[model samples]
Target: MKLSPYFHDLRSAYQAELDDLTQDSEGKDVLRKRLAEKRKEIAFLVQMMELAPEMVAVVFHQGFRFARPMALEQLLGRGVDDLPGWSSLSADGAVVLEPWAASLAKAVLAEPGGERFLAVAAGLEFMQAHSRLAPVASHAEAEEDDGDEDAPEHDDDYDALSADDAADPHNARSREEASDNWLSDVGFDRKD
Candidate 1:
């Protein structure tokens, strides 16, 4: 069975991840370098798999050097003389991965497709993990205290509680202790 669609899906996903990770020109450069590395690895995988579409396979092995995977496909679609015909199945797969694939296509459009896939995957995982850390409503409530607005600011000589302050019977704590207590109460690591 032709595995080009899997390769395409993988490549497309990587690019999408890379785009989300890299924010500046240096980051772009780093991401492109990674893409080139992935492309080379992919080329080797294709060769070992002994897939057809020899020219596409050849372009992959020969190295596109910092190019994006999607652009390479487009270039083949445009100018390659011995390109293999894309199967309808691959086209259908592309449609399924279209949302993520578009971002991947944008990231790798200009450079050669040599070794960038690994970086893409890392970026993808980071985005997914970051999305899972959002806090909840109960935690939000713990961060604020309702007070009478007309009360004058206290000018008493009371010093702020130090780090060891604990919650009092009134369910209140010194500000520093309160923050720590709130975080612990919510079962979330302060560092997260």
Candidate 2:
């Protein structure tokens, strides 16, 4: 799955954003409630359509179902300025929305850069469904790294998807307990 640097970069951020919404402090599954809240804020979030599509795109998580894999893969190769308009993609019925996404899509369509952002949103979703969100250094980035040997090999993204595991109380509790024991060994009192 060849990804444009744009989609590649946003993939992790979008996943992380969803992961953030997936659980609360008590490790309860709060995704539905949080996503609903985000949907209501679509009007405000539209402002970030192009600048930070991943942040705004979360409102549409599970909202897109791409019918044409090739088209989406092609779309991922284009730079931001070169993206196809949403009208074309939707016209072909290549990007289908979940039944619940209609009004939110309409709200987004009314914005200036909304169409392009939708295509971006779809590409992000496509990458996500295919499990292509893992970090892969692009050709240019790899070359740039060779000159500076001190650069970090990876982005410090939280687990590519521990956010998914966070939904399980068992995983979250074990992790919490492990952290407490580690802290105790380090001479700090366990956090109650």
Candidate 3:
């Protein structure tokens, strides 16, 4: 599948911003730590979206494995939430960010128009693909699913009906008659 040029640009821009964050002197350590934490959070979110319980435990460990309190919940746990600017995200740059209250207001007030929404959606898909969240089942695993007893058994008449269906696109046989029901149905014609 081909990705839009806009998505490619968005990805490159995000990477450049991340690189800029890593190059700062005063908060270089902090930014690097946050970057690692962000990766784990994204991974955890992906696992949750996939409903993969087996991978959750592993991802959760990485999510909170940072040295400093990287999240609001973490700071609250240590009773450090009351401190001035405790919840503030400090970044070294010309970027003038709003406080949490202002940020929330800004976010609530902003409306993403059609093009912006599409860009965001495409960027998310690109990120998920790059992060390896795109589901990829091996040939062996796919074969195992077909062999698994839990999978529904292929009806006996499937072979004949499939052949007929392929040859005659306008065949009047209902999809159900193309399966085991073919032998049981009253009007079904058996070529045998």
Q: Pick the candidate with the highest TM-score.
A: 2
Ranking by lDDT: 2, 1, 3
Clash pairs, model 2 backbone: none
What lDDT does each candidate get?
A: 0.32, 0.76, 0.31
lDDT of 1 by residue, 1-192 (tens): 012333433332333334333345443446455545554454244332222222122212212132233433332223223332222213433212224333333333233431233222222232222222323322343344235455434311112222233235332323334445444654757643
Q: Which ten residues in a row have the lowest lDDT in candidate 3?
A: 53-62
Prediction 3 global C-alpha lDDT: 0.31
Model 2 lDDT tens row, 1-192: 456677766766676667668899998999999999999999899998876688798888888888887788789877787999989898998889888998998999898888888888888777767663443324445677788878778633212334565578887576566545644764779787
* Per-prediction TM-score: 0.19, 0.69, 0.25
Candidate numbers sorted by TM-score from highest down: 2, 3, 1
Candidate 3, 1-192: lDDT as tens digits? 222343333333333333334445664445556554544454233323222211221222112212222232222222111322311322221112223223222331243232222123223322432333222323344476676888544321101223434357454333323432433343546654
The count of backbone overlaps in candidate 1 is 18
User: Given candidate 1, what's the lDDT at residue 96?
Assistant: 23
TM-score of 3: 0.25
TM-score of 1: 0.19
Best by lDDT: 2
